[model samples]
Target: MTDQQSKLLKGKQILVTGGAGFIGSNLCEVLLNQHVKVVCLDNFSTGKRINIEPFLQNQNFKLVEGDIRHLEDCKKACLNIDYVLHEAALGSVPRSINDPITTNDVNVSGFLNMLVAARDAGVKRFVYAASSSTYGDHEALPKVEDTIGKPLSPYAITKYVNELYADIFHTTYNFDTIGLRYFNVFGKRQDPNGAYAAVIPKFVQQFIDHESPIINGDGSYSRDFTYIANVVQMNINALTTENKDALNTVYNVAYGDRTTLLELATLLKTYLSEFDASIKTIEIKHRENRVGDIPHSLASIEKAKRLLDYNPQYNISAGLKEAVVWYWEHLK
Candidate 1:
């Protein structure tokens, strides 16, 4: 956090709706470090208790164990809150494919509940977790904010709906909001055990266990894999920026580069090999690409850079090195 950011966030009350999940917990940790009072609202469905365990002891942190699907819970969490970093949603495409109704309930309806709650409470700003998936089927490189294609899956639909609701909130209720369409984010404390675990952490844990990590396709598919710290920076900027032009819109929060699955698995193997040399011998397997997956995703972070002064510090290699080290120490 910059000196200005510290000063801006200091003593302010922020509510993180998914504060026990990977990205939300990271945001909570950063805000708490800046001496900001943080209220975390999560039902523990997809979020883990252990993720927010460290913050339980922090005087500046408070956990509100509640579901966002319920309007009452959203209202309760938003009480006296200055800003809302809404990260709660069912994230996986496969999970949504299996159960679109539940995904809609949480991602769409829950998101609307948060927006209404924030607007009613007169929260200063609402910064939310959008997805690069919203650029669905556009076949565009370096995705920009204005142009978006049809949603490819139920999960994508829910996320795009979030952006729609945010825009409506801004126009109809005069509520200020910013949506961050995050690329593939990874970092410390991210869960690697679940069935819907992210690629990097899952592969890292597999390598640590001397198991072959499976690539969904021939490994040519790529993503603008972003680091969590970059995302946190974007959220903080969105929350603290005084520029009126920066509000009531969305930004692609990314590291502005792409990496292939093969390259990513190779990088993980190389990094993890430092901790366990045997990991170098672990073969990477392959299968048909899953449904609702785009072939490639790269982000043009120029909008966030111009609007929010966003400058991501970690590229793929640097972030993978750091993530591998953490997984080695913890998951191993």
Candidate 2:
């Protein structure tokens, strides 16, 4: 992490697609802090204005109202950019199951457009948000790259396709790109009001509002819930590595630990109960496990450690504690 921080991106022209989304906004904030001139692009499909509102005053930051699905918009956003941190996409397994065409439009076609634009514009590197769900039905205790199972949902298929396309772009066009397969990432600025909001933010908001936090399938399923900071580190590291072997590769960005949903809810309840113990007694409801859901997922960070020098600072417990406080303070 320090390696990324030590090499400042001062005065570099950077374009962060999906810069208004949860992870995207966080990445933009970090890049701006490093004194980079940032161009942010988002169509607001799932991204929010509030995420980028604070940066409006920064002279070094620019926000473009554009969609990646539109090749012209991507072309315009990529002008004179040193790097592209592509984070825009239609996420959520349930949402993808409900409507796959839209997911394909945004996640697949949109990504292709960005690659072409970046390569054409001579961008230094392209880093994107991949998913742990790419492990799909592998049934492995700790998922490793290059051994993915068949993707079950449209969303997982989209992410897996992203890695494939990225490799093709590298060999075909010789453009530098990296894909970070993020585990469940939660942190500040994560929107909790959306229909497909992530687990941590959604539960935190519900508990704060004195509502019940629901668990699916008896809550035995687990994930390597990662924090936003670790992802930020990976993007920065990938962008700066100046190593040929690091380019055109994908790495799992996670804490390398696992926690079941039951454990997550209990932790949230316990933490929030500190302010008001009433939420602790709230019973959890178990619905039929959602379709396209995996039973368990943990990641092996050996590749990231070797290639990107990635070191995660926040484990799930420490991350959730900090994230819950942010949601309570920010969402309220």
| Candidate 1 ranges beyond 4 A from true positions | none
RMSD to the native, candidate 1?
0.7
Q: What tens-digit string does per-residue lDDT give for candidate 2 at 77-98?
A: 9998988899999989989999
Q: Residue 282 error for model 2, in Å?
A: 1.5
Which regions of candidate 2 are displaced past 4 Å? 1-8
lDDT of each: 0.93, 0.89
Q: Which ten contiguous residues of candidate 1 have the minimum total lDDT?
A: 320-329
Indicate the residue-level lDDT of 111 in model 1.
Answer: 94
Per residue, candidate 1 scores C-alpha lDDT tens digits across 261-301 of 99999999999998888888999999999999999999999
TM-score of model 2 vs. true structure: 0.97
**What's the alpha carbon RMSD for model 2?**
1.3
